[model samples]
Target: MIPVGAYARVSEDKALRANAADWREIGEQVAEQFKDMDALAAELGVTITRRYNDNNRPAGDPHIVRNDFEALLVDLENGTVRGILFYHSDRLVRQEYDAARINRLFQLNPTYVGRAVAGGTDLSTQEGRSMLTIQATMGGMEVYSTRRRVARKNKGLAERGHIHGGPRPFGWAEDRRTLHDTEAEELRKAVLAIPGGLTVGEIRKQWIDLGYEPTRNKKKPGTQTLQHSTVETRLINPRICGYRTYLPQAERRDAKRPWMPDFVVRKDGKPVMGNWEAIVSPEEWQACVATIEERKRARVEGRAAHTTSAKYLLSGIARCGKCSFPLMSNQYSKGTASHERYGYRYACLTTLGGCGGVTRVGPPMEHMVEEAFLLEVRRSLGTVAGQVEINETKHDVRLARIDQEIAEVSERRRAKRISMSTALDLIEELEGERDELNRQRRQLVAAKVRRQNISPSLPEEWKGYSVSQRKIRLRESIRAVMVHPAGRGRRFDPSLIEVVWIEGGK
Candidate 1:
């Protein structure tokens, strides 16, 4: 018997409507469709040699890359199969372009043919091609119809003051319009407390402490936590203030113009009040918004969040002598009883995590290190600065010469005096020299400027350097400042601090 191939497709959306118990039921449906193709093959006196089934697949677009369809096409082109069988032509292709592709294949391979079991259509005949084309056109129309139906339904639901379909919001019941009493009460209490100096982070911690659980939604499975961002988001939503803002899918896609969920939409020249109870007054909501803004300003200004405007002098350079991990600066509140004792310290990550025990007081250690560094710089400033200036001048002169040579070579190449290959080689050599000189010039200029910026005669010039500027100066001379902790209850010692000097440093 002549070998034939069979193809079957069933979309996930269709199987879901059929009330498929699981993927197994969908697989059974696919197998049943293949049996129909097998029956057709038996009638045609051809054995069903290979079967291709695309379960949970979309056939609306010809441009979509279907794995099984491509494989079947590969087999057909290789002349492994003389005929192809399908449950229906629409299952093989829904788009007109896909139908044209099938027609092209039949033209290329005259012996190859397509037969659909349901419609009894054949690709080998003109009348059968017409039938397949009409079926595909109708299938494409059905996709558009489905989309229009969904769009109309969603728009109607939105006008009725309800979200089309999504997971229920935190304070709302499954019906959406009705508020969940307990959740609403908790939310109201949280929002009310925000302006009273309680932060979003603090509110989250309070909710966790009180053992508050999140509302369960069928659409979103898994336990959810009341995070700081979540609290901040809930506080800012206008839904709690009794207004609905209709944000379409298109509006949400424009990232530059992000849809603010807290904004109230005007309908018929008036604000559309949501058909839900308000959790808090609009005035209270605005207060919460103001509080969040104030917190953000404070963090950026470094008045909060324990960050310093000045760079920590030894941030990346300092390492724990025991674990070899970089030391991090720890900031403490000012004017505490132990402000002078523990205000600032360089604490190792390993030591903090109980891997080792090494920490250094920031102020005293930094003061000692800087005093020693500056003294050394003062001793060699004249000799080092003069050499850097001379090297910078030499690099500039050589770079000018290299540029002139490159221009001469390019002009020669354009004039056809030298072969293209010879001109390219010379130009490449000159460009390399120019790059090297530029790099050297940058290094020498930076060194010269750094020395000029530092005035040994004026002690105040040293203090004028910002935290980042001081770090740059220190890095040039020091590789690492390895801190060995002084024993517990012992006096601070500069002898314990080991400053490893960088190679060729001042």
Candidate 2:
């Protein structure tokens, strides 16, 4: 019912960033500030209706927008709020420009007033506004002065190859020059296993099973264990390869975070190197990064790439009619000269839940699907052959562009104008581009290969291709095979199955 606007703010410190418990300490301070303002509002016989807070955010950052403060000003302009309340005037506006804007608002609206509970400064007349301006200017000066001092200290610490008073990075000692032997070994093992065909999740399981501890969290006063996220961060950080990165702090925005871009530039336009010992070689680090990136792309594009490495006829392409879940293939074999080869049976993974109860023998089903696919391919090979050639030509052009981009980045690195970390980041980006281009090239070539094998001129050539090659051809020509439960009395019935064919793209 009362129309009073209240504001509060606090800046974050290094201790608050490093120690999770320190957040509670900072929260209590803001709470106490609100307590004093609430008392003042009650003394004046008005309830505080709208509250604004910018806790742990910089007040003097030029690019930082104080959303709540701006909203409070909007409310004051429209005469929605009769008065503004704060523990002190400094908390309301630290920057001189912000303080002047508040003065203009008060001048335009003579009836609009502000009250500072703890400070005795009144906000009703000319002398009060002058004092408020002086206090805000002093607060602004303190903020900028502190910013310069902190920047100088951090730059010095970085130049010396020591962490700038935060939690020590994983796999490194407190001094950050020497590797922590046990943790460093785990880091090496994890990074090495990535390129050796182990998924990040698998590596996490192995480390957790071995009771591997992460970097010590001295702020928590307890042992910390390795986590998947922390593992990923350690793998990509150039610091692991004895390189220091300097990311300038910037205002938060919706587009990208400050640290998202490579910011390892030096003041004199020269490369910056680190004095610390390297935990992993640059080649090992790059390989690990590439593996992680490829895995991420696989997850985004299709679940087919994420399936078990077992070469099944339709591991990802087969589905159950009832639950629509993929039918996983299980391998079985009997020891004998004629039966030693692995046999597969496709069954709905969720069959135990009674949703998809279908089970089909792999060999017979695969044979039936292949026969149908060959028939369709024979009828449409002429149309698909033309499109395949067009796609191949397009891929060749894109591959050339990717090669040019790689050369450009290499040239930039040779100029010696950017820091080593920046050059490495650019190189990684170019490598990813190159890898994607090469994958497209492979797809184009494989399309051409399959077109030749499945040509109308040589229809039986498809049968001679490897199982993996046949699987790829199957995916290109068919979308899914939905398997239904066999009819009541029979063990398996082919009439109940539905094959979904993929149309050729022109």
Candidate 3:
């Protein structure tokens, strides 16, 4: 009927950001620390009633109300933990005040923070008190020793050219180059259809229309599953092009464990460049990788233009859906007006004056509808800002290699290594690679061109320009603006405005 408690602290280096818990290691450690308490309780015929553990926390971190460890410490103060027992003293208190309080729970502690009730074995006994003190000191040593061992082992592994284990890489089997013909061929098709080629959208559309299905997730029929980004990554994978890479450290929160020392391994259980057939040529792979990096650099170095006016926020996108028409925007005329409101509305255009009249819209009504729609959108889909990261060096090397291939091919033709027909064939081969590179190059070139030759970014309150100027900027940035007419009035019904797939977060 007596209650006793157990307490434990894990080694400090534990981090749970990887979404994995070393629960097994933790359980074992806790058992080791509380071993005495369990034995003592059995001897006294008392039950160990509670256990508190600081899981995945460093000892030095602040103990806050929201933190689990803080809650456990509070319980200790309230006598919920009869006589706090832990593997060690340092675990209970890294700071002096904390350690002193924990040591005072009982004249003779039992290493068992067992029952707060009266029937537990007497901790005031000489043997019981000594046993608890020895265990705490031992636990402290264990923590320090564990850290030193790990650091030494890691250093040795790095020197031996061995990468630590990590997430399975694509194309290879669990970090090995073992062959899986089916998946390999799928990868082949993916890289072959690179950027600007039948887009993943086009490829999937063709596949689905012809009744193709993936081995996984087959329940959903007629749905295209090749996301644009996924296919894009396949095209740039070094393995696809026959070269194996060693990514000793590639860790990002969204990416595989970033900053963690890991080596590139084939999917099958071998090292990269260990054993495998090259899927795509190195040249093509490099080209794709290069373009990706260039685009990323441009975007990162490129700043975003700020929009200050509400009209600029919803301008081209706020359209009516009835006839798929865009609503015209106008402000209140106030040169001499007594009561003109200053708001914006998107009303469907009226028919030719001969037949009837233009539809009318009011400003305040437009704001009401726009704000409500925005609120709903924000609630349903949380605001997200996606960042694009690229391995710059990898991409740069890839692009240079592709350019080299093209140059080398041209040089061979000039030297007449083969006949005209053969030369033409070689040129075609090189041209294929060149064209791929060109597409990526064009995207970058276009960006630079826009910066140097094109007009500056337009202002939201572009009262400086006429409607004609606004139309030009809209054409530059927008694909289309559609509007639907409601039965009555100059007021735009926000319900009729349907915004389609957009690139960034709204």
Model 2 regions more than 4 Å off: 1-57, 61-89, 95-121, 130-162, 207-228, 251-273, 297-506
Q: How many steric clashes between backbone atoms does each model show?
A: 0, 0, 37
Candidate 3: Cα lDDT at 300: 74
What are the lDDT figures for the candidates, one per model? Answer: 0.70, 0.67, 0.46
Q: Kindly list the per-residue Cα lDDT of model 3 for residues 1-506, writing each as its tens digit.
A: 45646656654433433444555235554555567657666766767677666654555322322244466556656656555444444555444344334445554344534331222323355454444455445544665576567767754553443544544344546554554546666566544433212233444454445554443434566675654445445555555655444432112324653211122233322223424557665444444454344444545775212221123333444455554454455554556341244444444546411112223344444344344434434453423245133222333454456556656777887898767787678767754664455445535433332223222222323444333234333333344444444575345455544444334323
When 1 and 3 are scored with TM-score, the better candidate is: 1
| Alpha-carbon TM-score of each model against the true structure | 0.46, 0.46, 0.37
Off by over 4 Å in 1: 1-6, 10-32, 47-58, 61-84, 100-107, 124-138, 180-266, 271-340, 343-506
Model 1 Cα lDDT, one tens digit per residue, 324-423: 7778888756877446675787878654563356777788888988987888787866565434233446655565666677778989989999999999
Pairs that clash in candidate 1 = none
TM-score of 1: 0.46
Tens digit of per-residue lDDT, candidate 2, span 318-370: 88888887888865556643234426678786544535577777887888888
